[model samples]
Target chain A: MPRKAADEIVIALAGQPNCGKSTLFNAVAGFKVDVGNFAGTSVAFAETRVTFHGRKIRLIDLPGTYSISSHDLAEKVARDFLLSGEVDALINVVDASMLSRSLEFSVQLTEMRVPMVMCLNMMDEAQRKGMEIDTSRLEELLGIPVRTAVAVVGTGIDEVFRQAIRVAGGVVPAVEPRYDNDIEQALSRLLAVYPQALKDALPLSERFVALRLLEKDEDFERKVGASSPDFLARASEERHRLAEREGRAETLALGSHRHGLVLDLYEKVVRHRRGNVLGTREKVDRFIIHPIGGAITVVGSLLITFFLAFFLGNAIAGLVDVPFGALRASIQAMPKGMGPAVLIGLFEGVVAGAGIVLPYLVPLLVLLAIFEDTGLLPRIAFMVDGILHRVGLHGSSVVPLILGFGCNVPSIMATRTLENPRDRFVTMMVAPFVTCSARSVVIIALAGKYLGVLATVALYLFGGLMSMAVSYSLTRSKKRKSLGVIMEVPPLRQPYPRIVVRKVWLRLREFVLVAWPVLIVSSLALSLLSYAGADATINGLLSPLTTSVLQLPAAVGIPLFLGLFRKELTLIMLGAALGTDAIGNVLSNGQILVLVVFTMLYVPCVATLAAQWREGGFKTAAASALLNLGVSIAVAGAVARFVGAA
Target chain B: MEGETAAIHALHSDGATRKRIQSLGLFEGRRICVVARAPFSGPLLVEDVATGARVMIARDLAENIEMESRAPEGR
Candidate 1:
């Protein structure tokens, strides 16, 4: 076979959440990616190259969205890429079971003036639900090539892409939405104001821009208004003129009119059975969401995932200690001070990287993958939505919060799926306070050993409560975020190994690619700081707080300082500094409690700091670190003074 | 109106919220099956029968919005 050029034709897979676009992409690309019943599981858009109809094409799977409206991230990602116009064609995936809602977006795509092949996906589910869609009638109505598939089962998938390729090869005219004469006249009047050269530079078709202008989309105002503020003023006038003719808000009038056309199209091609065929799924939902059973099920799952990951991580981590410790001893015994420091620092990074971190991180990520793949997590998110809303988070934000227990970096990555930046910021800010697995280990080693297991659980519960309280306080600002939610409640299904493995792989890949480098480098860097004769100065600076205020030995100061790079080091360094294996011999119960509080609450681990910086930017990340410092000192001091050590 | 269907007369929300609600298939004149109303003026668990997609609306918004009974049982 002859080699194809490297200029692969870019084709996009677009659809609403849970439409199985990922599954179809997985099937065609001969690769696996996350598949989940709920929304936002595929947090980022990714591309894979495949040969379709003897031509190589790059298939990009985008985050799910209902429409091209840029109110949310998913919409922004999809529409931004589409309007870039680099994509040769779009595989517009419509969930056959939810034809009316899905088609609402399909109409918007038609106006984009791009070649598109409509993938009427989930035909098996639609048939199972006693719904019927006439594909020929739909194709005729929308004037686009249509293909049907149950993508999860890999049925009719090849035909879908084949049609897509043919359509992309210039087989059909762009389907433009036809609105009322008055609106069209108003739109033309608005368009006449823009010079042809300027209009050509607009991201979307004149019709789409006109519709958005009528709707008064903020993004359009910002982009177009930059060069031509005069256009915006004229467009507003035209909208009101059209509204006066219709006797309603022009945006609403336009929406009602366009939706009427969609309903007309829907009526022509689709029919529904009188009875709901979702018997089994609904029955199971009733149990999982039953007020009492729901709480138990969610709570039980949390316990199982946390404890399983915790014990398993500890057990495997135990195996790494011998090898890592041996390596550490060999390095330390090799030479004099600086030599030992450099070698030990790098070795410590390695020990922390693979030995300490990965064991705990792996099990937690795998469990989270399973939770999302099975669709159980979103429902838990739904149940907590009411409470979490008090803190300016969506129900979907709960996914990141729960995963924070396992680790914070991946949880921070999970916030990408949240539509609103405010939600993402607030969630990211509060997530570190969720007390991660490493913190849990710290609490167990310190509080459980000294204060009792009850105290350990109490500290975890207290951390959770403080996070929520702080989050609620954060939402008290005057930013005016709407707390309303419109999240999907997907049926829980058994996770396919292929899909779940893909999710876990992508997550761990992120761990390796982004988080690990920072973890290792920061570990080495902090060690180099200690080697450069700064430990005494750092210990001296922290002495007042560690020795006097929170009532701990000056030795504890180094661990407190080092905990920022990797939190588990609070325990490891405390032992090293004291030169003893038995921690109980060095501190009182209340003193131990204060030390635990200090480590647990102060500055998030360096890996988490890196994640925060990457996601929330430097200002917010720095603000988070400073805030943690303040809160840790205040809370730890209060506890130490009130409890009074033996 | 507990078990009956009702048309969304107006969303009583701003431009973006209204448009988003429409994307969920709940536009003006669209029918919704009211599954259950939570106690203490909480969220309303409602379903769009046509799409078989359900949503929980905050009680505050649900109250301000006006709707007419679409089905004979609630009509």
Candidate 2:
């Protein structure tokens, strides 16, 4: 195969929070990226190469932001990138049904004068809603090539690429909307002071920069730098004069003017009607949002998820046990030696770590991805918004809460969406209590086998209730003002099978990469400890806590240490410590419940700790771990006493 | 003879109006009604459309907002 030359074309896929921007990027780039309905899911830029017409085009998928006004970090990144004029073309992906709001962004992009293409995505949904937008009129009004696309189904994808390539190749004309006369006059004055190189490099004309300066966009001023401060000062003064003459601030005036144009464009091209579908959607929303119905749905979903995890975990555990049983039998049949003991230990460790825990974790993550992709999660957030507000956290924090079900590392990372630092910290500190899949595995394996299904459910509920209580306490300690919840609920769409499968696979791969090495090393270390006399001493020391409080054998201590690296390893090591069938027999139901509860609320895994360190420094990570440890111990002690008494 | 004039507390309409309102939390059962219309046909400040809450939005955007009238004069 001939090597294709890299035709570097920076194409930005921009849209609202859940309008399938990431999904489209995955379809085009053939890579797995986070896709969720709630805001701030994509914080960083993801780049990939796609071959279009035998040319490699580098596509940059930026975080979904509401506007280019630099109100937030995601918006700042999008605005700066567009202003930098480094990109060959901008591909604005709009949700077709929500054209009115989506078009506002396209119009804003047009003012920047970047060679752009409009991809009208979700065409199927638009048609279903009886929306008929005149594409040609829209194209003419925006002065950009428009391509209809159903990105999930891969429709009109080729045309999207073609238009993008054409725009990059300078075949498409840029649309520079005319501003008011006063603004134009100020822009001309500012333009004369700009260096020729700077003028040539910027995507928009000096007029745009002047307008931004008038609006006091810090980023715009920074981009212009010290060289044009005098000019910027004059521009700012002129803008004030213009605003004074118009009897309004320049920024508000400019906003209304742009909004005026947006309204005109929507009036001209977009049409809608009273429809039954809208009514149906509303009725459904009522059911989903009602206090009783919503709570029931949430609990039901969680119950189903647990059952699925249990079923899958048991199957994988059964398969793993067969090989282990065979190996143990064969080893006993062989001559007595250290080799047989070591082999048995190694085989037992691998099966316990990989086979039992991974299957459960992987499926739960898949179900989570599906729930998120299908757009039902945000409704759940809306339902809980009232309670979350009372707790001093915004409803948007629900994304992190839902993600906590899959893994706390990503859940902690999702806290970046919270605008208030205090809120973010509180959310991060409490998020690990959401019963992550790793803990779920431990609960299912231990509580289910020994205690019962009801006990396992109770354990999970305890973890959740504990997390909320901690969050509530943390928020109260700060005595902060209530943060408002502003979230976009993307219309529920069926999750694309391809995207969901790829996301699940990618998440599972990440887990294996991060946890597998740690699991193997921990197993080997534990085996060595057992081989020496150290295991006996360690067990003896842990016996007081395990027996008096937890009421479990001393051997369970080794697994608790392993839980720090990987939660499921605790169950595996526990299984190995107390044989497969005899596990429930040896450890009483109360002991098992305590063990499960402790493991669930225990310190986060090593991967999560590293993520914490990266997200919030070393001090924060240490604080989080130590806090969790104290809570877990206290909770376990209490649970142990209660269960023992019962 | 006319019995009495009820103070309008909700504004309801359909089509593009409903969509504009729906997006802004001005939907059925949402408390809002047009409080005042601007002289220059600018934005309107409406009491809640769904919850009878209050918000101010551009009239151009407001035209798309839909609301229903409160029960006439307390039935």
Candidate 3:
């Protein structure tokens, strides 16, 4: 099996987690790549073309991994790419300050004999810490070019391209790391038994596989077995013999041996400063983390965020309502015809869902981006670490919980950051129960029409308490051990206006695109059902649950059911069902409070249900929806009973 | 105790250990100052002389760390 000639250069950008690899990729690529599903899998990959020396270069930003060992999905993706032999060169991004750990991966790549160059990123931070590395010596030891970079500040970018082009052009030879004599002898013995074809196809040197086999890496065994099962078994026996002679696991010995060499090389080349310096970040942290000061700041920030979201949403809703009102009035003027009613109803649903709700979500997402960009979210996470621990989650879960207030889909998606499976699952399950902006519209409209603004706020508080109680009870019953929050709190910088706006617009655009179609279809369906006298039949069935148990009119259940498709449609449906004036006369203040509470705790919108299934699987999704329905019914029933008695 | 500060000792136990220290700017021949310590056994505020940046680290994490104070030698 002969290999295909490299028609296009495939370069892999590899690094350890949180080492500024993504930042560097974003800086270099800058929206030039098509971001979508990677080939056949749902996993996303960004593909872009850059004209380097007049030749198009294809760059693949591989998932960041700690090592090539297949312990996780990220590691498997990275290791498979490296072993594929399809890539022409590798751009190994290393954090200068965290060189030693970065170097361990670099050593593994060097053993693969891949045409590679090292990008020592974060030079600014490294220099600030008063550390200097002798790049020349490092290059000599690793047998590859080493380029220093401060990626965020856009330094050494040209050098990165220059080295990449050189490697791609075959102007530079792959560098091989010098291993210990014992390992070298064993590798040569192992290679002697390998078939010529197998030897040529593998990207890494025979020695690297021999070392991995000694370590008993399961993935390595499977890979070797694919080529020669007999050879792999023989190699395992040899590894056992070597481990007994060495009086240790051959893997641990190999790691120590590599560390020893990296240390020897670093000793001669690295220099550092003596004492620490006082910086501005420390001064700011004092005020932000102060028990009293932190509380004030947190409250103030949250209030401002909510106020901006509410005011902006109200303004946008006012602007959108003018056309909708006119369109409805025109349809009513036409001789009460079925066609006019159906067209007008569909228009109302789209207007309510997309025009009114999505615009409001934009400003809120923008405010969230400001908080995330300025690094205030992590500080807030720190402040709530104590409370979060009590609920079987770490402080990091706060981000997703906060995001739930904006939209539950992304909030559930954000749960991927949590390491523990149980924590992620529980957070995703409960996030939709946190009344989002869509629910706010229903609460406000009902409160304004029947109750008042004060009652609306009180109902919101009640909803929040219910969400917390459910979260606590579920977590406690599960008996999940609280994991400590180990997060990197990035330095606070002024938010980038362009990036913030782009992120906000992107999210808002998704809301409009997905929500508008569903809303319009739901509105049309409801209108037809009403015209056909189906509402009466549905209300007759709903009377037991709404009128008897919840002590509300059967008419209210139609809108509540429609609310599951689009939340703002609940208000619109209620408006059409009860009319503006009749709603006030029909439902008393106590009944209105019951309605608002039930609506807040009821099943999430259809889009959110789809997101739930995607994030939490079918069982969790079905269970979450059923739980919401059960809780809404019980709470509404109890509240209605108490209010009727009072 | 004063004379012992000037004595040459094996400051770093091993290479892997030394690399971890170096990456965090707490390498051999580097100076570190404890700017502030939290009440009880909370987080510590420390400054790195090389970069002049102060960082807050948990006290428990700090306990596993070893540092050489270069302040004994007059700057």
Candidate 4:
């Protein structure tokens, strides 16, 4: 939306990836932004309004980007927002620990001539790194108000925003960073030849235009081409001459020029006190990233998370089961008629949702939040790159797969980080098999309750293997080698308990608001269907596969079939279908295992299918659904036969 | 590969990969140290000495970026 209020300051928080831009924005915006330690975590922009000193501040949290030149989707989102000319001021949040690299992006931002405040964020990290940044010196050099902040702890954030508001309200002209003589000369040459009218027509500064053209920024080049085709010819000729003189591509020359400038600037402002001693962070990081030790840490963490969720979920389930069981018995004892039956159906839905799902979901989300905040996901991605390569994927795919454990919708969206379409498609296709938290609810509640913890762990392992096998087969015919991963491994930070709780509540709120309503309505709808005796038809129709092939009860057909809408429905509606919440009494251990496997492998829920359609197009989504159904039948059938044999 | 500083010779990649590499501050002439190398040819974790930015470069991409190793600097 365009700024309707002239007094409203539209300030955007911009920075390099994993530099705490979101954290700072969250600090001011009251936890509206998603803060994760992984780069590219903020794929989209988040905007909120704050009343700072009675002045409305429209705060925008942009996706972290290393440079405006890259065409990655996340970077594109950030670049588009910046170039949109709507931002009144920018908060260039720099990771003070990595001052030089962060300065490169800050330098790039200055070229836009936007009123900006330099926020030396993560001051604690810099201090821990034994580096002291002279903020005043940085302010003096950059000609902008610079503030130091440890955003995580809420240190210096209000002052940083105050500085930004002052910078926006006042005439604080952006100080253009100067480059080496060669780049300056080249830039001047290009600007001198460029038409004044055309330069003024563009939203960016004339110098930024010249630099972008020389650096071959496609979006800028296209804009300039649309304005004046004649200027493009001159720019390319100048670019060629500069590339020849630099003995490299014009893009590389521009980047190196900035690199040299930033290094020189770094030496001027940063003082290293604890010279060369690896801090405890680096020491622990080394052990964590070690091949053997890292493997142990990674595997052990997963096992611990699984067991904790299993036991904790069971305990919660047990606590709630007593009250829900009494409620069910009271409803059943009311009468042996349709009214009581339907009442029991509605009651069972609430029981399954509140008692069964939340028990497992709450602990799992808490752990996932801890994992995300701790910055371990990227390391896992790095460690698994080689293994993924065997399946025609790479480390980048691991992010989406790991995220899939929480839910599939965002996980599919996370595939935007993968550059290759083939990689994205394969990852999207394989990701749904990763057993999202909703599926985990079913697996834990049913499998954990009846089959034991090892059986549940084995089932999760089986899902992982199936995902790998499916991805391998999907890419077997395509011989194009996957691109190697180039990902930033952000420093691990202690997970703040408050933020973790907030994050879990955000996810849990979704289940309460969206999924619970659907659960209750669907439960009621199924009850009505059974009242009309239509569920018998659904169960009978699916019985050919559910009963004959999987050797499960026909009544389970309704839950299994309706589960395509929400995986939890299969478990929620199970008691309603089978006439009892005590599932072990009716279904044996082997039968529950077969049902879990089938539910896990079946077509992803409606939300997931919609996400797949949006991300991979109709054909990919349809093919995926078919592939899932095919795999579920085949695998579940085999499990049933094997169980029978045993 | 560990405890060595290397000046990047060149990135023998074109298009997006090269752009991504350069964007991450892995430009030619920058010195970097291999901090960790995962087993089974996973990825090499390299820290740019000048910037203190650690990047995980997959072995294939690492193979393409030529560099000349030097002895570890004295503390």
* TM-scores vs. true structure, each candidate: 0.82, 0.84, 0.76, 0.95
Q: Which is the winner by lDDT between candidate 2 and candidate 3?
A: 2
List the candidate numbers ranked by DockQ, top first: 4, 1, 3, 2
Q: Cα lDDT for residue A212, model 2?
A: 76
- Candidate 2 vs candidate 3, DockQ winner: 3
Listed for every candidate in order, the interface RMSD values in angstroms are: 2.8, 13.1, 6.0, 1.2
Give a tens-digit lDDT track for model 3, residues A47-72. Answer: 55566666567777776665676555
Task: Kindly list the per-residue Cα lDDT of model 4 for residues A1-646, writing each as its tens digit.
Answer: 6554777888899998888888788788884666777777777778899998778989998877888874676776677777777777889999998887788888888887778898898888788777878888888788788999888888998888888888774444446788888889878887787886676678567888888887788887888898777887788877788788878876675777788888888889988885755767777788889998899878988987898898888898899988877777777778567787667667766777888889999999999999888888888887777788788775788888898999998899889888888899999999889899999989988888889878888999999999999998999999788887888888877888877887898788889989888888888878888878899888888889988899999999989877988999999988888877779999989999999999999999999999999888999899999999999999999999999889
Error of 4 at A15 (Å): 1.5
Residue A41 in model 1: shift from native, Å?
5.4
DockQ of every predicted complex: 0.47, 0.05, 0.10, 0.75
Interface RMSD in angstroms for candidate 1: 2.8
- The residue-level lDDT of candidate 2 at A427 comes to 77
Winning candidate number (lDDT): 4
DockQ-based CAPRI category assigned to the predicted complex of candidate 1: acceptable
Clashing pairs in 3: A128-B51, A129-B51, A274-B31, A275-B49, A276-B47, A276-B48, A276-B49, A277-B48
**C-alpha lDDT (0 to 100) for residue A198 of candidate 4:** 78
